[model samples]
Target: MDSASVPFAALDYIIFGVYLFIIIGLGLWVSREKEGRQKDSSDYFLASKSLPFWAIGSSLIASNISAEQFIGMSGSGFRVGLAIASYEWMAAVTLLVIAYFFLPIYLEKEIFTMPQFLEQRYDGRVRMLLAIFWLLVYVFVNLTSVLYMGGLSMNIIMGLPLWGSIAGLALFATAYSLYGGLKAVAWTDVVQVVVLVGGGLLTTWVALDAYGGSSTGPVGGLTQLMGDASNRFNMILFEGELMYQNDEGVTQDAYQLLPGLSVLFGGLWVANLFYWGCNQYIIQRALAAKNLQEAKRGLAFAAYLKLLLPLIVVVPGIVAFALDAPIQRGDEAYPWLLGQYVGTGFRGLAFAALVAAIVSSLASMMNSASTIFTMDLYRNYVEEEVSESKLVRIGRIVALACIVVATLVAPQLADLDQVFQYIQEYTGFVSPGVLAIFVMGLFWSKATPNAALVSAVLSIPLSAAFKFLTPEIAFLNRMLIVFFVSVALIVGISYVENRGETHPKAIDLDDVEHDSDPIFQVAAFGILGITAALYVIFW
Candidate 1:
C-alpha cells in the first residue's frame, strides 16, 4: 500500500497545499495582537475572554473530533457496527448537562483553567496535583494518540512515512498555536470545522456512490447498502454474540465494548461528563466565552454537531463493511475508502479534511497544556508576580516542549489495534474518580479537601486492581465501581473530618442566575429531547 498505489493526483496536492496556506493565514490573521497593546496572559491563553457563541461552539467540536473519531472510531464501526456510536450520541446529552449545570458555576467564578476551580473549592495542593496530571495526560495520551492516528492515516492514503507525517503534523500545529495561542486555535477552528465536515460528507457521499455503481443514485446506493448489510446497523449487542475472533483465538462479544443498555444509564455517563464538563482541552473553549449565555449557546451548537458526526465517521466504515472492502485491519477502513472511491480533486479535499481534524486537535491540546502550566504551576508557584509578557513567553516554551515530547512518543503507539478504545480504557482509570470528586465538591458542602485528594490518589490503583483482578468485567462497568468507591471514600472522610461543623458551601451556586436565558433553555431542552429520541430509535 504505497503512495503510488493510491490515486492521488496533482490536483489533490494543489488542493491540500491551498488548504494549508488558507488555514495558516487565517489562524495568524485572527490571533494577531493589536498594534499598541501587547498580548497579556489573558489574551494569549483565554482568547481575551471575548469569543462569541459560534467560535466557541465550532472550536469545541474541532478540538474534540480528532483523528480518534475519524480513524479509530470509524475502525470500531467497521468492527462492532453502530453500537460504537454510543460514545458520540451519549456525548450530546453530556454537553447539554454541562451547558446548563456546569457553565453557570465556571462563569460565576471566572476561572481560566479547571485546576483554578479546584484551588478555589479545595486548596492549592489539590490544584497543583491535578494540573500536573492533566499536563501528563495531554502530552502523552491526547497529543501522542492524535499524532499516531494522523500519521497512520497519511501513511495508508498518501504513502508518506509515519515519522515524517508525525513530524510534519507537530510542526504545522506549532506554527500558529505557539504564537497566537487559543485565539488562533479557536477562530481558525471555525473554518476547520466547516472543511472537516464538508470534506467528510464528500467522502461518505462519494464512497456510497461508488458502492451503488454508476446507474444508481446516492439514495438508491444508501438503500441498497442498508438492505444488504442490515446486521451492521444494529445499535445494541447482547452477550455471547461474537463480533470477531482475535489473534489470541478468543471470540469477543460486542457487549465487551458497549456493555448492553448500561451505555445509556450507567458508567458511560461518567466518561462523557468528565470529558465534556471537566477536561481542560475540550472545555477551555467554552471557558473563554464572553458570557454564560454565549457559552451555553456554544455547547448547544456542539450538541447538534455531535448528532451529525456518526454520518461522517461511522457511516463510511459501515459502508466499507457492506462493500466487503479488503483491508488488513478495521482502522484502515477510512483511508482505504478514500483511496478507492474518491476522485482526484475530491480526494485532496478529503485528505485536507483529515488534516483539519488532526491539526485543530493538536493545536487545541498544546494550547491547553500551556495554559495549565503557565497559570497553575509557573505563575502561581515559581513567580507570584510574573509579568504578563514573561508569562506568554513561558506558555510558548511549554507548548513547544509538549509537541516535542508527543512527537517522540507517537510512534510507540503503532502496535495498538484500536487506538480510540485504548485511550478510553486507560483514561477510564482516572475520569470516574475525578468526576466523582468534582460532583461532590460542587454539590456536597461537607466534602473536605483531604477527601478529594484521597479520591484522586486512589482512582488509578482502584481501577487497575479491578482490571487485573476481574478481567471479565467490561471497562465501562469497572468505571462505575471506581466512581462509587471514590465517592464513598470522599463522603466517609468528610463526615469524620468535618465533625458536626457545617462549613459554607464549596461553590455558591445561587450567586449566579443562569436560568433566565429562555432561548438557551429551549435549546438545551430540545437537545435533551433529541438525545432521548435517538436512544429510543437506536434501542
Candidate 2:
C-alpha cells in the first residue's frame, strides 16, 4: 500500500507557502508579550485567560479535529458509511454537558490541567498517576497517530516523502507554538478554523460535485450518493446489517466499532465525555475563557460546528465509496479525493487546510502535554522553588521534547490500517476509569482518594480481561462493562472507607451557580433538535 502521488501545480505550492508564512507570523505576533509586562506562567500556559467565546470554541475544534478526523474518520466513512459520524454527533451532545457541568467545576478551581483538577479533588497521587497516563497517551497515541495520518495524506495528495512530511509538520507546529504557547495556538486557531472549515467544505463540494459528474450541487450529489450506495447511508448499523472490508482484506461489520444501542445509551458517552471534558488539550481552551458563560458559549459554538462536521469529513468518504474510488485502504480515501478532485489553483488552499488541521492539533497537543509535565510533574517533584520564567521555559522545552518523541515514533504507524479506530480502542482502556473517577469525585461526596486510586489501578486490567476473554463483545460494549466495573469498585471502596459520609475533600459547589444561561440554553436545545433531526432523516 504505497501512496501514489498526484500532480501539484506551482500555484498550489505558492498558496501553501504563503499560508505557512502568514500563520507563523500571526502566531508569533499574537504571542508577543506587551510592553512593560513580564511573561509569566499564566501568560504562557493559559493564554492570560483572555480568550473570547469564539476563540475558545474555534480552538477547541482546531485542537480536537486533526489528521484523525480529516484522514482517519473520513476513511472510516468510506468503509462504515455514516455510522462513523456517531462520534462527532455524540460529541456535540457531550460538549453541552461539559459546558454546563464540567466547566463550572474547572473554572471554580482555576485549574491549569486535568491532573491539577484530580489533585484538588482527590490527592496528589491520583493526580500524578493520571498525569503519567495522559503524557504517555498524548505522545505515543494521539500525537503519533496524527503525525502519521497527516503525513500519509501529504504523501498521497501532494507527492511529499513520508518521513519528510512528518518531520516538517513537527517543525512547523513548533515554530510558533513553542515560543508563544497557548496564546499563539488559540489565536492562530481562529484563522486555522476558518481555513479548515472553508477549505474542508470546498473539498467536500469538489468531491460531491465530482460524484455527480460535475452536474449536481451538494444536495443533488448527496442524493446521487445515497441512491448509489444506499447501504452506506445508515446512521445505525446492526450486526451483519452492513459489512466492510478491513485493511487485511477480511469482511467485518461496523457493529464491532459502533455497536447499535450502546452508541446511544452506553459506551460512546464514556468516550465523548472523557475526550471533551477531561482531555487536557481539548479543554485547556475552555479553561482560558474569561468566564464560565464564555466557556459555555464557546462549547455551544463548537457543538454547532460539530453538527456540521460530518457533511465535511464523513460525506466525502461515502462519496468516494459510491464513486468506486481506486484507494487501497480506507485511510487513503481522503487523500485520493484531494488529488483527484481538487484542481490546480485551489489545491494549494486545500493542501494548506490539511496542513493547518495537522499543525494546529500538533501544537495544541504539545502545549497541553507540556502544561501537564511542567505543572503536575516538575513543579510537584522536580523543583518547588522554581521561578515563573523558569516554569515557562520548562514548558517550552517540554513542548519541543514531546514533538521530537512523537516524530521519532510516528513512522511506526505505517503498519496500521485505520489509525483513528486504533487510537480509540486503546484510549478506551484509560477513558472508562477516568470518566468513572471524575463522575464519582464530582457528584458523590463519599468517594475517597483511595477509592479513586483503586479505580484507576484496576481500569487497565478490567478492560484487558474484557477485551481478551470475551473477544466476542463489541469494543463499545466492552467499554461499557469496564466503566460499570470501575464505578462499582469506586462505590464499594468509598462506602467501606467513608461509611457513606461525604469525604472531607469532596467539592462543595453550594455557592457556585448550577445552571446555564438562558441564551446558552436556547443554543443547546437548538443543537439537540438539529442532531435529533439529522438522526431521524438519516436513520
Candidate 3:
C-alpha cells in the first residue's frame, strides 16, 4: 500500500508536465480576440458556430469525462464489477444516432441551445422552464457533484482536509473559466483529455502489472479480486434475495443488477440517452460544433473515446479492490491507487491529471450554465438588445455565480450513497422525456407541437410515478418503461394533433452538409467494433 511499490518512473512526470503545458497553452492560445466586430452572445456561447471537428470532439470528451468517472464511476466499478460499464457502451449507440440523425437538424436550424429548439417547437414558457431547471441542475447536480467529489479524491491523494481541497478546486476552475469563456473551456478540455486518459491508462497498466505480480498467490493481482469473497463486485441474477449479505453480513446490494431483463434493455438505455444526448453539460459541446459534418464527426470521436474509457476508469478500480487498498466507493479508488502505486515525480503528474480532469469538468459546466442563462433566459427575456461586450460580461458573471453556488453545495456529496445512481435518478425525470421530444421532432414530421408539449409535461411525472410505484422494479427497468410510455404518448398525441394539418418545416435537411473524411469513418467503425467486443467479453 505504500507509494514506493510501483513501476512508475520520472518519465511519467515528463509526460504529465508536457501534457499540462500543452493543455493550458491551448486555452491561452485559443483565447485570442475575435476579429472585426465585437463578439455577440452566439460567439461567446456557441463559438459563433465555428469550432472545428477536433475542438468540438475534445470538448465533448473533456466535458463528459469529469472527475465523476475517475472518482465516482471507477469507484463504482471497483465495487460493482464490469456491469457499470454499460453506461459507456450505451453511449456508443446513442452517439451513432446523434451523428446520423440529430446533428442535421441542430446545425441546419442554427440553434444556440437545446432549449431554444424547444421554444421553436413548443412555446417560450417551456423553454424558460427548462432553462431554469437545467441551470439549477448544473449548480446542484453536475457542477457540485464533480467539484466536491473531485476535491475528495484530491484530498485523499494529497492528504488535505475537505475544505482546503474543495475550495482550491472551485476557485481554480471558476477563475480560468470565468476569465476565458467557452473557447477557453473547449481548448482546456482538449489538453485535459490527453492527461486524464493517459493517467487513467497509466494507473490501469500499473495495477494490472501489480495484479500479475501479487505476492499472496498464483492469481494475478486483478484476478485475485474475483477469488476474494470480500471483493465480490459482480452482479447477482438470483431472485428472492433482493439484498444479499456482504462479507461483513451487512446487506448491501444497492449497486447490484439482476432484478430482471428490464435493466439491461431499459434502465441503462434511459440513463445513457439522457446523459449523452439531452443533458446540457454533455451536449453543449456538440452544440458548439462548426456544422453538421463536424458535429457528427465530433460526436463519433467522443463515442470512440467512450469505448476506451473503461480500460482506464473501470479496470483499474477492480485492480485496486483486488489489492484490498483502503478506499470508499469508486470515487476514492483512483486517488488511493495512484498514491499507493505511482512514484515521486510521477505522483505530481498524476495529481495534475486529476486536477485537469476536475477543472475541465467544472469549467465545462460553468461555461454551459452561463451559455443557457445568457442565451435562453437573458437574451430572450431580460435584456433583448444588450451589446456584445455586455453579453459576454453577463455570461462571465453567470459562470462565476454558478461556481459559487456549486462550491457551496460540494460538501454535500459525502452525504449520498451510490452517488452516481442518486444523480441518475434525479436527472432521469427530465432526460428521457426530453430525448423523446427531440427524437420525435427531428425524425417524425407529423409529431406536432402539442405532442412535444404533452410529452415534455407528462414524461417527468410519469417516470417518477412509475419509479415510485414499482418498488420491486429496478430503476433502470422502470426508466425503460417510462421511456417507451413517453414515446407512445408522444406519437399518439402527435397523431391526434396533426390529424389533418400539414407539418411545418422542422429543419431543412437538403441544406445540411456531410463533409466527413476517411479517418472519421475509420474511427467511427473502430469505436463501435471495440464496444461490441467489450459487450461480448463482459456478457
What is the clash count for each candidate, in the order shown? 0, 0, 5
Report the lDDT of model 1 for residue 369.
Answer: 97
Estimate, for each residue in 21-62, the C-alpha lDDT of model 2 and write its tens digit.
Answer: 999999989988779877798988899999999999999988
Candidate 1 matches the true fold with a TM-score of 0.97
Models 1 onward score TM values of 0.97, 0.98, 0.88
lDDT of 1: 0.88
Task: Judging by TM-score against the true structure, name the best candidate.
Answer: 2
Candidate 1 per-residue lDDT over residues 179-291, each given as its tens digit: 89999999999999999999999998898888888799777788788788777676767776637643244567878788887798888998999999999998898889998
Put down candidate 3 lDDT per residue, 249-326, tens digits, no spaces: 466664434343444565676677667766777777778786666778888878878888877777766777667766
Q: What is the TM-score (0 to 1) of candidate 2?
A: 0.98
Per-candidate local distance difference test:
0.88, 0.91, 0.72
lDDT of 3: 0.72
The worst-scoring run of ten residues by lDDT in candidate 1 lies at: 241-250
Task: Write the number of the candidate with greater TM-score, choosing between 1 and 2.
Answer: 2
Candidate achieving higher TM-score, 2 or 3: 2
